[model samples]
Target: MKFTERLWQDIAPIYNSILKHGFVNELMAGSLPTFLFQYYIQQDALYLADFSRALNLLAARSIRTDDVLQFTQFAQNAILVERALHETYFSIYAIEPATQKMPACFAYTNYLLATTSLQSIAVGAAAVLPCFWIYRQVGKHIYQQALQENPYRTWIDTYAGEAFDVSVNQMLAITDRLAEQAGAAERQQMQDAFRISSQLEWYFWNDAYTQNQWQV
Candidate 1:
C-alpha cells in the first residue's frame, strides 16, 4: 500500500474522533497555564534557535520552490509571534529568560526539525500537521465554550485571536496541498510522521503538566 493510504488509514479514525469531540472547552482552558508555564516561562530561546537551524538545514535544498519559500516565511512569522509571548511572560513574571528550561517544548520543536531535516516534504507535513490541526480544533472548541463558561477569558481570547486562526488554517492548507501532490509512499511516510507527532503532542502537554520530572 502507498504511504499516503496507510497514513490516512492510521489517522482517519483519530482525526474523525477529535472532530467529533468538538474540542474540549474546559480542557483547552485548563491547558493554558501549562502552555504558559512551559513555552513562555520555562522554554529557553536556545531551544528555538536550535530547532530553527534544524529546519533551515532541512529546507536548504528544497526551499527554492515558491511553495517552500512561502512555508518558510510562515515559519519565520510563527516564531516571531510565539516569541512575543515569551517576552510577555518574562515581563509578567520578572523571570530571567536564562533560567528557563522548557524541555517538552524543546522536544516537540526538536522533533519537527529532526524529522524535516532527514525526511521528505511529505514527511515534514506529517510531522507538522498535529500542531496545526490540534491548535485549531482546540481554539475553536475553547472559543465556543467561552461563550458560556466565561472562565479563562484570556486563554479564550488568545486562541481565538485572528492571527492564530489564520496561521493554523494556512498551515493546514499547505499540508493538504502537499498530501494531494505526494506519491503513495511519500504520503505513508507523512502519515507515519503525523501519527507519531500527534501522540507526541499529547505527551508533551502531559509532560508540561508534570513539570520538574522533565529530563529532555
Candidate 2:
C-alpha cells in the first residue's frame, strides 16, 4: 500500500472521531454558537500566519525548483485563499481577534514550524498536510447537511468546494512522492508527524467548541 494510504488507515479512528466532533455536528445543524465560531476563526487567522511560514521554510529547503515553487505557491494560498475566509468571518462576526494566539492554536503551529525546521522537507510537509487534507474531508462531510441559510455556509463552501479539493489532491501527491523515496525510519517519522497533526486537528475544533481561552 502507498505510504499515504497506510498513514490514513492508521489515523482512521481519529478521522472518524473528527466527523463526529461536536463542532462539526453543531455546524451542520446550523446551531453552533456564533461566539464559538468567532473564536475558532480568530485563532485560525493567527494560526495561518505561522502555517504559511512553515510552507515557506519547506520551499526554501527544496532541492527541486518545482518543489520550491509549488511550496511557495501553497504558502501564498494559505494566506491569500484560506485566510481570506477568516477575514470575511471577522467582518461578519464583528469581533477583533486576540493579539495573541490561543493555546491550542499556538501549540499546533509551533509544532509544525519546529518539526519542519528540524526534520526533512518531506517530514515538514507531512506535518502540515492534515490541515489541508482533513479540512477538505471535513468540508465534504459537513456540506452534506448544510442548510442554505446556514450562518457558516461560506466557511463550509470554501473548504467543500472544488478549488480546495484540487489543493488537497496536490498536497497528497506531494506527500506520496516524498514517501516513495523515504526510508522506513523517515517514513515512520513522517507518519508520526501526520498523525500528530491530525490529532491536533481534532483538538483544535474541540478547543473551539469549548471556547478555550488563554489563561494569561
Candidate 3:
C-alpha cells in the first residue's frame, strides 16, 4: 500500500469520530443552529489565513521546482477559493470580521505553521495533508448523506466538487512522492505529524460543536 493509504488507515478511528460528531451530523441534517455555524465559519476564516502561510512556508522549503509550484498554487487557492466561499457565507449570515482565533483554531493553525517552518519538507507535507484529505472525505460523506435542502449545501458542495478534488489529488500525490524519497526515520516523523494533525481536526470540529471558549 502507498504511504498515504497507511496514513489514512492510521487515522481511521479519528475519521470515524469526526463523521459521528454532532456538528457534522447536524450540518448534514440541516439542523445545526445558525450561531454555531457562524462561529465555525468565523474560526475557519482565521484558519485559512494562516493555513495559506504555512503552505507558502512549505513552498519555500520544497526542493523540487514542481513541488514548489504546486505548494504555491495550493497556497493561492486556499486564500482565494476558500476565502471566497467564506465571504459568501459572511454576506448571507452578515458575519462580521472575526477579531480573534478561538482556541482550537489557534492551536491547529499554529501547529501547521510551526511544523512547516521547522520540520523536514516531507514531514511538513504530512502535517498539512489531513486538512486536504479529511475535508474531501467528510465533504463527500456529507454530500452523499446530507439532506437535499440543507442550509449548508453550498459548503458541502464546495468541498465535494471536482475542483476541490483536483487539489486534494495533487496534495496526495505530492505527499506520496515525498514519502518515497524520505528515509525511514523521516517517514516515521511524517506519520507522527499526520496523526497529530488528524487528531486536531477532530478537536476543531468538536470545539465548534461545544462552543468552547477560553477560560480567561
Clashing pairs in 2: none
Task: Identify the runs in model 1 with alpha carbons over 4 angstroms from their true place.
Answer: 1-41, 44-59, 98-103, 147-155, 212-216
Runs in model 2 lying further than 4 Å from the true structure: none
Q: Which of the predicted structures, 1 or 3, would earn the higher lDDT when compared with the native?
A: 3
Give the clash count for each candidate. 5, 0, 0
What TM-scores do the predictions have? 0.71, 0.97, 0.99
Best by TM-score: 3
lDDT of 1 at 154: 53
Lowest summed lDDT across 10 adjacent residues in model 2 is found at 95-104
Model 1: C-alpha RMSD to truth? 4.7
lDDT minimum window of 10 residues, candidate 1: 19-28
lDDT of 1 at 129: 62
TM-score of 1: 0.71
Task: Compose the digit string of candidate 1's lDDT tens values, residues 1-216.
Answer: 543345556766665555344124334444444343534345435445544554455456465476557566656755686577666656665656654445666667778888877788767766876765665666676677555455344545656778777866666666776778889787767777889877665555455445535555
- Across 1-23, the per-residue lDDT of candidate 3 in tens digits comes to 99999999999999999999999
Better of 1 and 3 by TM-score: 3
